[model samples]
Target: MSRSRLMSSSSLSVHGLGKRYGEFVALAPTDLEVAAGEFLTLLGPSGSGKTTLLSLIAGLAAPDDGAIRIGGADVTYRPPYERDLGMVFQNYALFPHMTIEDNIAFPLKMRKVKGADAKKRAAEALELVRLPHVAKRFPRELSGGQQQRIALARCLVYRPSIILMDEPLGALDKKLREHMQLEIKRIHRELGTTIVYVTHDQEEAMTMSDRICLMNSGKIEQLGAPGDLYFRPRTVFVADFLGESNLLPAQVDRNEAGTLAVTLDGGAGSGQAIGNGADLAAGAKVTVMVRPQNITVRPAGEGSGRLKGRLTDIMVTGSLTKLYLEALAPGLPQLVAAYPTRTLSDDHSIGDVLELDWQAQDAVAIPAGQ
Candidate 1:
């Protein structure tokens, strides 16, 4: 039991999975697959169906439709215990009455594993979490971070084919949460266990996930590597939900080359829709989504595609500075830009005319919000 007693590389797949609570659709029909050892994060705002999807995969709740497969075996109808998967709950469901070692060994004992083997495996699991000496400590006696490590180690004891985490680090403070993120990454690298992590924290998902599946309204919004989803979101919701975006409504028209031209309305220097934009019908209304970090600020008349505006506010935080400006385009949204303090444009106070512009390629155009 102290040796490699792990399950074979497993790929978890859900086909047409859906769930309901009375008349409310908790989860819409969903199809997803996790390759063996891949760290896929389910990211979305609260009530976006991420938790429902995770619970379905873990067999904590029965699915109303579709099938689930693990390690090439259909397990949709199987109970949680029979699915051979480990789940780390958000509340750190550790036994308050047990010692750390006993808590880690609980799973093995439930499975009727031999005493000697279970103890050896529990020790190995404790060591894997770098907490070998804490085995004798009671759960209530340990720090919150220590208790979390114990919960993780307990999940690791059985070496299930897949591990599902539902906001496992949500309770920890900022510093400890960051530390645990690295720890989880290290364990995943060492054990190569397939992980399906659910969290509403975008930064956390970006830090640990190999890829992210963004959910919205009980359906998958976008699924891809973090950068792909952030940089090139396919839908308006995807663009707005994944990160901060300056969504400027504009008119779109196609050129002779079948390219979309965007016309953003800013007061004096507002650009008109010409045949020079993304792919959209002529005269169609679209929204230009740009990240605050992508915007370059300058004194009016200094940059191309500049939106002349008055500096409304500025914030200087440690190595970064954020600038907020009133819109130059009569109906344009307020402009926001964030960048390194070392890269600040000339010193300009409030009432300074500022222009905000970004490379055309940096801005994504999608239909106006629904």
Candidate 2:
């Protein structure tokens, strides 16, 4: 078998991509650029167009209006086989009748390579996936992880230029999933392949991806590295959906020095200000979102900008304690704080009045009213 060495493309670009089923639009016009050798994961809830984009790129489905380019070549309507892309699915599609050796050699056979060459390539691929010892075993005789590795070996046998993985680890147990996450990351680094992966798990995306394309409502909400998306999300949906947040409604208040002051209103602890003398006159009804870990809890009344709340519940999770507090005001939102166990000297019980304080820079003020 003549092995086709995988070559890296400059980038994969999707322009004006759209997909529709009858009257309903499955995906709106979407544009994305993935750099060569970059691990870009598409993350979203179900029916959010993540899978649609994947299918379109894989040539499994057609785009209503867009062109996909790889290394400056148009591949929008190319057949799957001609696209030179490797695909790994949620289910490991292995042949029960064939041994792991034959299964890994299947792609090379389909491309009309045979006999000694095919066998040699299959052996090499099994070695690449660290499954050389199990080459003679059938799919039914192997563990789930072994079978998955065989599936990956099959994809790599053809040495496709790009690899597309659609929730490939969704079936594994938590421990196995974490282990395979590292395995896949290692394999990707060794092969230096351009990979487009899809998953709904935020932690998985944050752990493995070089950049993440976050989707919502059939469109891309934001595209950035994990830290950027977590700390500097541009929209409310991106902030609220990516992680846990305490979203308090605030309004922009301009002071005499021409600075922006964000005011939260419900009662006393309601008003907070940031960018005191900056030029934000947008008057946008904004939502100030803070992470649970960002809130500092002191006794009752030491901090200057303090809120009064009664401890509603405490959850101890070995390393840290999750505290839930209800504000004294009738309609103010409940606040959640995560404190390291080492941070607290005397453990406070429920119903104790606690003061919650945070620096203005710790929370981000999003645009008014989403």
Candidate 3:
């Protein structure tokens, strides 16, 4: 119930941790290390193995291969209750018949804490969640958001070594979900508890994680900070999956002075771009990745870079405006640019010819095959 009781977190390590269901691989052999008090999110689409990895870590499922260690102790075959880990699922998973205080104290009771000690600890957990006033209310009497806070309070009451959350905010509405995201983040920061969260929402992962482990086809596709995964993706899938990208087909012309010069296919555009430290030989096929926000739109012949297109559509969404342009060159896909709504001139309209340009440092040229 004290601050020290809540702050005793631990590190987690997964070495070649894998899971399989007959011929289908739910999670490929993977190696990962989460530092003590670090917030890491397992992020990917439904079948990408994020949930499977979380399940394996929570000891809900046994790994077919590899080992899992928490705080330097092997927990690969430990049961869920014996792993010293707490979990928050999509559902609140609270006992409807129990009072909020009792629900939060349930874990301590199971651990054989006396009635007086359990009651005091439950009060402290509710205060930690800023919901001490709702201790007497039952789960059914509270709003969805309040119930979720209670669930988290329950998880914290036991003072587990690590906390694992599987889309804990998935059941809430958008506004409430966003609010709870901040609440959970605040609690994590205050408790300094090492947390492994699983979510399919990229924005959620980006907002909450110190590092994102992006999985694809039961394997880790990329692992890094949100900005690194967004701006310096290692593969085409990482580029396309994390955000909106203009993937221009190109052929490498040369690799000189840390820059890779490339010629765009269909003569759409040509420019120098940064590579991912790999030597790309001349005439090699590649894809130039440029984020929508990095593209600048200007009058023809006004910008330094050369790529001309006709504006096809304009969309305004409150603070940001999106411009869709179709290149004049054949075989090139349409390009999109997003800018602050106030920065765009009202004179620009659809069907207007415009020039597109981006800094070389802002673009990356990746191998075509990844």
Candidate 4:
């Protein structure tokens, strides 16, 4: 069967969605949209409401406020079964007694699809997941990754308009989890089914999502393409949560045209960085965020706008090496610089004083606390 025959996609809209449990708010009034065939991930740490939002979308929980529409049809009050959706959970949720083929066909059987048609579609679903040979095996006979694929296959067999996955790859090992991420992306590309996935893994979100909705404290903190949130984060929390960053406290000296000249706190050094579209006036306190990969380390006095620090640690992790520097200035925090392992030379020692600098554009000056 062609990809179109396996699944049909739909758009999703959430309007002022809110949920609460007694005095605790689970989700704030939130609005979101998932385009037809788009993959969006709800990303956050525990208690951040990503799962709460996913539950509301799946019709597993009723919202305290606002409405939900699937493919522009109101489904806020509908039961989970009434919503044309498929769900894959963290656990495989496969019945131990059922064969792989039977597991895949179970949803079809519920929908009254029987006999040869159910069997054939189940086979097709297994083939789509690249595990057609495992048809006769029970759930216990398959590997963790294989069982995950089977769970996904079961969802696809029903051709739900939208698919909801709540940390479906959470149970796998690191290597297998990464492999499954690519596999799921490939399947999404082929099937074009709208997917609203929830996970707390930032790397997973960066790898699989077309757009990521980062939730915090029962509210969305940021929503955008992974790069957008990484490179141009609006707040300090966004910068700190998505990846490692060197957030230096600074006081703005002046706004030179569009660039802002700032003096690092603790008398580290003076440098310039681009503001995040905020009106950063002279004397205002701000934090300049520089990604570890953006900082360049060189022999002392060899770089411009330099901050002198002692090389305290060198961690080599195969493809990349991380250098930790303790700033010589009393109040400055330690900084980390990441470089490809091949680009680093053995000339530098752990106790050596080094100069660290970065391009102005590579650093973002966000107003303190924002």
Considering every candidate listed, which one attains the maximal lDDT?
A: 4
- The TM-score of predicted model 1 comes to 0.91
Q: What is candidate 3's local distance difference test score? A: 0.90
Q: Candidate 2, clashing residue pairs?
A: 1-117, 259-277, 264-270, 285-368
Model 4 CA deviation exceeding 4 Å by range: 343-345
Residues 1-370, candidate 2: write the lDDT tens digits. 1222533434789999999999878899999999888899999999899999999999999999989998778999999888879999989999999989999888888899977989987888787778899988889998888788888899988788789999999999888889889988988887788899999999899999999999998999889999888876777788778887777777777533433356665754544434312245656676777788888887776665457679999887768788899977555688888867775454778898888877666777666644
Residue 366 CA displacement from its true place in model 2, Å: 0.4
Error of 1 at 306 (Å): 2.8
- List model 3 lDDT by residue over 1-370, tens digit each: 4558765789999999999999999999999999989999999988999999999999989999999999999999989988899999889999989999999999999999999989988998999889999989888889999999999999999898799999999999999999999999999888899999999888898899999999999999999999999999889999989978998889999888768888889887688789965678899898889998898889887875477889999988879898899989888888888888885467678899888888889999888888
How does model 4 fare in lDDT?
0.92
Please tell me which predicted candidate would have the highest TM-score against the true structure: 4
Task: Give the per-residue lDDT of model 1 (tens digit) for 99-123.
Answer: 8999999999999999999999899
lDDT of each: 0.83, 0.82, 0.90, 0.92
**lDDT at position 236, candidate 4:** 91
Clashes in candidate 2: how many?
Answer: 4
Going through the candidates in order, what is the number of backbone clashes in each? Answer: 7, 4, 0, 0
Cα lDDT tens digits for candidate 4, 97-207: 999999999999999997899999999999999999999999999999999999999999989999999999998999999999999999999999999999989999999
Candidates' TM-scores? 0.91, 0.90, 0.96, 0.97
Error of 4 at 3 (Å): 2.8
